[model samples]
Target: MNSTKCQKCGLTNFATDLECKRCGTSFVQKTRNSGSRPKFSIIAVVMFAGVAAAFYYVFTGVQGSVDKVNSVEANRVNAQPVLPPDAGRSRADYDRYRSQTVANAVGVSPGLAEHANRTQQTDKAMDQMTNSRAQ
Candidate 1:
């Protein structure tokens, strides 16, 4: 006949018995098999690492392309037109030409907004010159 050992009182009991007779402890046999636990595999780890690296590579490539396009647009918008050299011009004529150049450049290049302020100063100076000559 098969017998089960009581863990609490160390009493041997028949397998059919529900509880130990001496201490009233239940007799349940513990299995020593380790098959229920999960085992580690290197292939799973390597595959996960490869998928992470692929996502990083794709994200970086897209970000780099966007940055490159933004830089190109910035360079194009910031570019200023080159003007020809002025030769043999009176002070009033040169000031008038410069004012006209700045006025024409007002919405063409966003970077020239600061230089547009000089057109107002040029007009003020021209008015002063004309008023002084009239007086």
Candidate 2:
């Protein structure tokens, strides 16, 4: 290899030298593109490792949970709520009967009907304003 002078001490050494080889001064700071990564690069490596570990744990945990649910289903016919065998009919049935009783005879409040009419008029006015502006 060819020789070059050190910028700090002016000492001459081979071109492939890392240090001055005389004053012990470093030739230049190592960069990422230069062969191996430096020891101080732990931050980036640790962050990458942490993200990968977290993703791995999440994926494996989700897979385990899914497998557990599938196994439970495979071992049983179906799951049912913990209720008495002769449980009474649900409240929905009573509500259904009430709704049917009031279906045709249901009445709307006069105030609500007036509010709806006002809303329709306001919408029509706004539409007219927008059309006028566009022209």
Candidate 3:
């Protein structure tokens, strides 16, 4: 029987033995191709593709919502008030007229309309007070 010398411990072993007796070194040459690409299972590939698609869908939906918000803001900025600018009209009168118009359009009861008008007046008074204090 041919004997092979251990590279690590220098102990001689039989050719038929799988490992060095003294050092536990494997004698069999590895047959794996080091240059070959790693294999991915079909399930792994599908999962990766699904994740990519989900991200794409989420990004697109977010972009669409952002576009809608931008469009709505643009419309609000560009919109003209129902009443024309008149020097004779007091700020209170203008607010009352605008609120009445809105109430008429929405078909609200007279009591609710009066409450809305009072709320608008209160808000305007508070805003004026805040501005005066700020100055």
Candidate 4:
């Protein structure tokens, strides 16, 4: 007795069966594979590869820029100011140099400097008055 295996239910049936007894699947029309890649699948694979390559290119470019920016920031953070040979030799010399620099800066706008001095004097007088009243 020759038997045929049902493709859907894996059940053995008689060779004369038109459908599987267990699953009711018809064996009359059978599906065939042609051993070739489908056009849609090939196009999908190509599109996926192109998208992956584009993402890789963008990621590498962004990583390079981030590295460059980090290096520049590290350089800025580690950088020190260049000083003159005679600068900061003694405390008096440093103080004198600092005062001269301040004077030069203030000389650019004398009225602003004068206003700042007046404000300082007024603050001192107010402090003195408060201290006297507290005492």
Candidate 5:
């Protein structure tokens, strides 16, 4: 069975074909019939392409912004000065100290001893608890 058609004269000789011997016609149709189930409409194809392009651009744009933010954060981490370890401090005090250090880097030096005292107070409280529990 000849599985191809001659596009030259509406001859359905074979469809999975290349060209008509009489007339050169591409058998593979790019557009489908309007009445078909999977009908191909110009408007529909354009709309789909447009939506795909929009989403692609939006995702790429947001990804670029995320990359920029991550780079900036990495730079901040690199630029930050590591503080010397202070004795007798809670985690919260250390966080505050880091904040102060960041502020100081930006030209606002907060006294390190202030929070250090608070850490010592916290340490004293913890010591009391430990002693009470031991008793």
Candidate 6:
């Protein structure tokens, strides 16, 4: 069989021998393969890309919803109350003026008017519950 030469002892040794038989010198070579990292497979790369894309999609969708909520809140905060010059002269006059303002804001449609009324009632109920709990 072909043999390997031991560098330290200058002795010929069998290729499978870990050390020189004559001087007991180690003949083992450190493998280069142990230091190299394995390459990523195509399936692993595709899975990572898919997860990243899903995260991006979810993030943008949530951000868009947050932006819409912020815009609506800004509009509500910036809205000016509509009132007549003669408003608040008496309780009855004030009530009529308030009703007119609400009607204008909620639209003239019967369905819209009912919806607005229900929303107002819901707000009142929630406020009552909160006040009661506070007490």
- The candidate scoring highest on TM-score is 5
lDDT of 1 by residue, 19-74 (tens): 88898865443322334556679999999999999999999999999999999999
The C-alpha lDDT values of all candidates are: 0.81, 0.76, 0.83, 0.84, 0.76, 0.83
Model 4 lDDT vs. the true structure?
Answer: 0.84
TM-scores of the models, in the order given: 0.34, 0.31, 0.37, 0.37, 0.39, 0.37
As for TM-score, the candidate ahead, 2 or 4, is 4
lDDT of 6 by residue, 1-135 (tens): 668787767888888888789988765542234346577799999999999999999999999999999999999878967656774399888889899988787796788889878999999999999999999
**lDDT (tens digit, per residue) of candidate 4 on 27-113:** 766422323435567889999999999999999999999999999999987896765688448988888989999888887788869
Q: Which ten residues in a row have the lowest lDDT in candidate 4?
A: 30-39
Candidates ranked by lDDT, best first? 4, 3, 6, 1, 2, 5
**Candidate 3, superposed: residue stretches over 4 Å from native:** 1-37, 80-135
Off by over 4 Å in 1: 1-36, 80-135
- Candidate 6 lDDT (Cα, 0 to 1): 0.83
Residue pairs clashing, model 1: none
Q: For candidate 2, lDDT tens digit of each residue in 1-135?
A: 487677678889887887778887675553223456555677898999999999999999999999999989966745645656535757897788688766534345666567778999999999999999999
Cα lDDT of model 3 by residue, 1-135, tens digit = 588777778889897887889778877742123236477699999999999999999999999999999999989978956766588989999899999898686566777767878999999999999999999
TM-score (C-alpha, index-matched) for candidate 4: 0.37
Off by over 4 Å in 2: 1-40, 78-135
Find the candidate with the highest lDDT and give its number. 4
